[model samples]
Target: MAAADPPSPTGMGFFGMLSFRRSATAVASFDPAQEDELLALHALHAHVADRLEALSSHAQPQGPVLSLPFLSKLLDAVLSSSDAFRAVLALAPVAAAVSRPPADRLAADLLDRSIKMLDVLNAASLTLASLRGAHRAALTAASCLLAPALHRAHFARARRAIARIFPDDAKAGATAPSPSSRTMRALSVSVSKNWSAGRHMNAMAAHLAPPPQVPAAAAAGAGCGLGLALYTMSSVLVFAMWALVAAVPCQDRASAAISPPVAPPKQAQWAVPMSSLQDRIAEEWRRREKKGSSSGSAATAGLLAEMQAVERAARDLNSLLEEIAEEEEDEQAAVAIVSEERTREVTEQAEELAAACRALEDGLAPLERQVRAVFHRVVACRAEVVRCMEHVPRTASSNAAASASGVPPPQHHSF
Candidate 1:
């Protein structure tokens, strides 16, 4: 036999082997029609949701899961719906602001939505791994298209998680002093006055500012070109300032100058300036001095008019009171005469209440029957469900074993 030439690395034979290996791998890993893959992803999602529920029921952590850094990674890996993530995270600050318990509705909703998002991610990841052919190509394209959306979703979820972890503080800080008071104090320091006086002057002084001082001649001479320009400019500035000062109304300057020296308005300044009002008050006071002055001519002249009217009213009131007393006595006598009637009314009402209670009790009878009937139906339904579900494990085991033995599964209903 002729000696076989050494296998050439550059030859078609080597290339053909490499291609075959690659094709085999592609075929093994790709599943374009991966129905089971999709199902598995869904199953995993459901499992995760159930897990989240279990976590919620148990004692809540000091912080919400939404705030967790892991959530950011997980969400980034899986989320595609940016709007959905934002909606959920938006509730986080609200949950924190209310200082609610972990079981609060907003927090629970966030947990539920997060669990759902995880489900979506699990489904997507599985779909990415198992997909093949055109389906794989489509999903890959879709994932690229949705990249921004996924990123935004991750950001929104992260924000919500932060809100849940840090609740708002109702008592944030001490109350600040009023703005007016602060303004007064600032003015007092500026013009060498007390706080009370400063308040009145500050508002008017806003317009009475003094001109800036001129720089010294030596300083001007020693200046660089810019400084010389500034120094030379000083005279022009003084003229401008004087012009501005002259433009201010005389009344404004007078008010501004005097305001700081003024004190707060006194109570008498608030009262109406009328001599008659003072004299009338004094005359009314003098009438109450003597023992007989309480009913004297001076007292009865003007101020005692109302008191005289009150005396007449007292006489009327006493007459009315006597009439009312007689009427009340008559009413009491009548009430005694009708005591039997009231008792009869009460007895009738009691009997009616007893009848109503008996009727209510009777009404519950049918409800009791319904409850029992429902209970039995539920039991039957549960048994049927258990029986149906029980077959699943055995069927799965059998299918697995048959697959291993090169046997086919039994044909069942097809969708």
Candidate 2:
């Protein structure tokens, strides 16, 4: 061969050959499809790290840990990850089709669980309503005429009304605080009064459970990669939902048990960040739970910054009221002068609470919309999977489920 290729620099050289062997080994171990799927999974993991983990730093740098912008982007990441995961599943090997019995059951369970999140969404919306009520109470109190400008009697009455609305639920059967307006009255029913955040989230956790582990023998067969991918994606979904519930306010809120489901096979690239996210959230939750417990409140605090803002504003305003509302009148004049300093303090807190309310509500509107979108997306994905995996006719209950979830039956299965 003319002694020509004396250790050519390309593939024939020592280093080149070593690289080639490594490449060949990788190729032999994973077909291009599996390799691509793995890259996609890595991307998903990195996204969680990049988007979700980044929030921890921003929690202090920007403002509140769960600021409005943070929440908006958090939901965006959730939706984006869902879509990306579904894309991966859509492109899985055709051989994966026959072996999807495990995934089939998984998809069905996920679909059912997604519906249960509606109740969570409803509960969150109710919490938002309660926030609005608190905001209204702040406004009513702020408008009260203090010492000089208006009658002390008027200020006293306002204080009493708002106080009625502000009692912690630890006091049983507390009525909604009467507001100055009918709308205000309606807003005062704190979800914390009757709703149990712990119970609702526990129900959500029920749906977040991991699918049964596939037997090793079966997993070694044709669709092993797809099965792993499904389980991995399911773990991501479970953690995301549990995290969302943690961020919202709820009563008797116990952290959802997610260790089993959130933990993927060891050494997984995604597992690190997933576990990190879980740990941070759980830590924050424990902190909040401890704080609420120490404070003797019936409902536990939430992870949201705005939630804290709401509480602070309410507490400060109420403190001011205790000093002014319970005051023994001088009885020298009909007009009680509200010192400008006192008025300023009350106004500041009112505006602060109002601003916080707007931000929280603004954040919540998109969050709820995204939750609904998630619900429908899961429904559609499940429908597609059912069509692809099972040739059997659709049963009445399945059709009803599809109907109830608001995603029409798939007209045709193209994937």
Candidate 3:
């Protein structure tokens, strides 16, 4: 009997998305040429670009900004790209093709990037927790919106919990900063004012830092295709992380922009799609960035469709609270009329908040799972890449690589 095919290297969650084996081969043949490997890399990158474009285009109704749907696809793209990247890097040919120095450098770049991404995941988890806290508080407040007896009581109870999300610049250097006013805490990021996501993002950009120019295949000598592929992979990896930071709320979130993605060469097929998507997302970021909290638009609160909805709904509820309170003061009534219109207004606003809350509730758990999945994917790929370089000697041929490693040449599973 024939032996079973080896376990897929791209992880079981994603392998079903695309065949990772050499199709139509009667046996486990795994020979592919240098040009075929390069084409495999190109196809991988193009698939990523196509998915991102589709993600943005289809979600145009959600202010065409990054939404929950867009983020889901974006994270999927990262997973697919990382799979292709690590799969290619693990091949005996790739190990043979890239020299030790350049390979080490590439691995170092990716490893550093993976470390930064972990930090991003941590911040994202915290930010999501803050949002969940605010979400629950909003629901609680909604329950009390029309309850005259609970007006002051509910707001008093929720005010402190919800206030922890807004960022305050004055508190940036404070070892133990005092909370801001109720109005100031309406919507935004963490109460951890000293933590500047922008600063962290900038540091990451400075660390992985793009090269002045991507080397020509000829200039890269024997390992041209693999070397160039690694560089391009690193660039896309960095851009993906930067995009994640921008799409989610964090401390000083708007400052999370990284230098625009390094454009792929015009000759590359994915160049047009990739560049167009970058321009579109940047435009969205610019629109929200300019509106900002100072612009008095809740639109800048976040790029998530549900996040924006939740904040707008929260504002609507807050406005109703203000109006009712003012009405009570003017009429000088110890008990305000529980009139149909007033109750209706309160109910409508609370329902709006509930709708937004439901949207967030439905999407957030999956979103968290995806982020955690991405974190582990990057970790696995980084370890594989480092191991790839460590096992590959400086001057080994593909045969030597296969022989030394006691494995067959790996197949190129280009989608």
What range of 10 consecutive residues in model 1 has the weakest lDDT sum? 220-229
Superior candidate under lDDT, 1 versus 3: 3
| lDDT by candidate, in order shown | 0.27, 0.53, 0.60
Cα RMSD of predicted structure 3: 9.8
Backbone Cα, N, C clashes tallied per candidate: 4, 7, 1
Assess the local accuracy of residue 222 in candidate 1 as a C-alpha lDDT between 0 and 100: 13
Distance from true location, Cα of 127 in model 2, Å: 3.0
What stretches of model 3 exceed 4 Å from their correct place? 1-32, 61-64, 101-104, 146-196, 206-220, 296-301, 394-415
Which of 1 and 2 is ahead in lDDT? Answer: 2
In candidate 1 the C-alpha lDDT for residue 302 amounts to 17
- The TM-score leader among the candidates is 3
Question: Which segments of model 2 are wrong by more than 4 Å?
Answer: 1-49, 61-64, 92-105, 143-154, 157-161, 164-174, 177-220, 250-261, 298-301, 329-334, 391-415
What lDDT tens digits, residue by residue, belong to model 1 across residues 290-313?
Answer: 423544422111122222232233
Model 1 misplaced stretches (Cα beyond 4 Å):
1-338, 401-407
Comparing 2 and 3 on lDDT, the stronger one: 3
TM-score of 1: 0.19
Residue pair clashes in candidate 2: 146-338, 147-336, 147-337, 147-338, 148-336, 148-337, 148-338
